[model samples]
Target: MAQAPPMNVLEISAHFRVEHDKNRRQFSIRLNGSHDKAVLLYDYVGKKTVDLQHTEVPEAYRGQEIAKHLAKAAMDFVVEEDLKAHLTCWYIQKFVKENPHPHYLERILH
Candidate 1:
């Protein structure tokens, strides 16, 4: 059965469709009728952990808080899956610090 998205995921979807591709280890948003994308990249560590490594938004798509949405989607996935996270990406680190989610923040691995 296809499961429902988490509440935060649903909320973000309303603004932009943040798509997660597990095999690719990235979460991305591509605007409608546009080919560019805003993406957050991560790497799996062991079995239940991830290292958020980088985020990039096309120049044409910058200054719209798209990175923030990507951060939220990726972090929400980490929390929903009960996985530990290592915030190697500066933006993700900044995002977490700015918007506190106790349960999600607790999963950060140092």
Candidate 2:
């Protein structure tokens, strides 16, 4: 049987979709008709691990929990792809520490 999707998929805002740019190694969210974006950056380590490097939200977009959305999208991707996560971004680190999921939590690399 197939496992359920991570919480992020159901919880992510319908107003924006997190777009994974594999070539750019980042996940990004943009509001409709807006150039400004919230981004989560990551880099692959070998084949199975990803180092979550940084998260950024435009000044105009701050205080809207966009960072949290980005974190959720990134984590959801990690769980979906069966990849391990090494969190270097402080926001993402705090996100995982604060919001624990049974299956998703196991994917974190110390």
Candidate 3:
């Protein structure tokens, strides 16, 4: 049997999709091409202020900018909802600091 070639970042990312379960208070993305693969998890606290609590990406997906995508989605949700943000998650705090988007930064809870 001929072996299949590995997928590039764009191809891999294209196959994945993020789901926001408001009931569960989490954002997740399943790994592509594997039914049993671990998902990237982003847990948050939502109210007047949405506290980004934790982020866990599968080891295999690290360095692929998956976490960045997850953070962006969560931040975008906060912005769209007109709520403040509390960065309790270290990764999220760092992401906001490094990326420095004015829209996101303006909503951060001091």
Candidate 4:
């Protein structure tokens, strides 16, 4: 059987999208889409530290690690854009802890 094409992460205006399907339900993580929703926001001062926020996933999508994918996208963006983060969001903090990438944290505004 021919294999299905892998889902290429789609980059939106300021975010990335990874679609998902679960038991007839469709969902996705709109990474860095909107700070009011889930996005990367910079500080008022140096504008160096960006904050990441992820809303509680829908009931059907809970415990599915969609947030991790979103976080990874954020981290990747940080590197690609050469930006730093404050990690105000809990999930993002945990992600930085697990990844141990210095590029993101080292540039943090102290």
Query: TM-scores of the models, in the given order?
Result: 0.86, 0.84, 0.75, 0.55
**Clash numbers, per candidate:** 0, 0, 0, 0
Using lDDT, give the best candidate's number.
1
**Cα lDDT of model 1 overall?**
0.85
What TM-score does candidate 1 reach? Answer: 0.86
Q: Predictions ranked by TM-score, top down?
A: 1, 2, 3, 4
Order of models, best lDDT first: 1, 2, 3, 4
Per-residue CA lDDT of model 3 for 27-54, tens digit only, reads 6676765653333243445547777788
lDDT of 2 by residue, 1-110 (tens): 98643323234766667777777888888765588888899999969999999999988888888888889888888998999989999999999988999666899988
Per-residue lDDT over 1-110 for candidate 4, one digit per residue giving the tens place of the 0 to 100 score: 98664444444334336543222122246534543222233232335445554434545555756566666766665677577656666877887788877776674543
- Full-model lDDT, candidate 4: 0.53
Cα-based lDDT for every prediction: 0.85, 0.84, 0.70, 0.53
Comparing 1 and 3 on lDDT, the stronger one? 1
Model 1, clash count?
A: 0
Which candidate number would show the highest TM-score if scored against the true structure?
1
* Each prediction's RMSD to truth: 4.3, 6.8, 9.1, 11.3
Task: Give the number of colliding residue pairs in candidate 2.
Answer: 0
What global local distance difference test value does model 2 have? 0.84
Worst 10 residues of 3 by lDDT: 4-13
Query: lDDT at 100 for candidate 4?
Result: 79
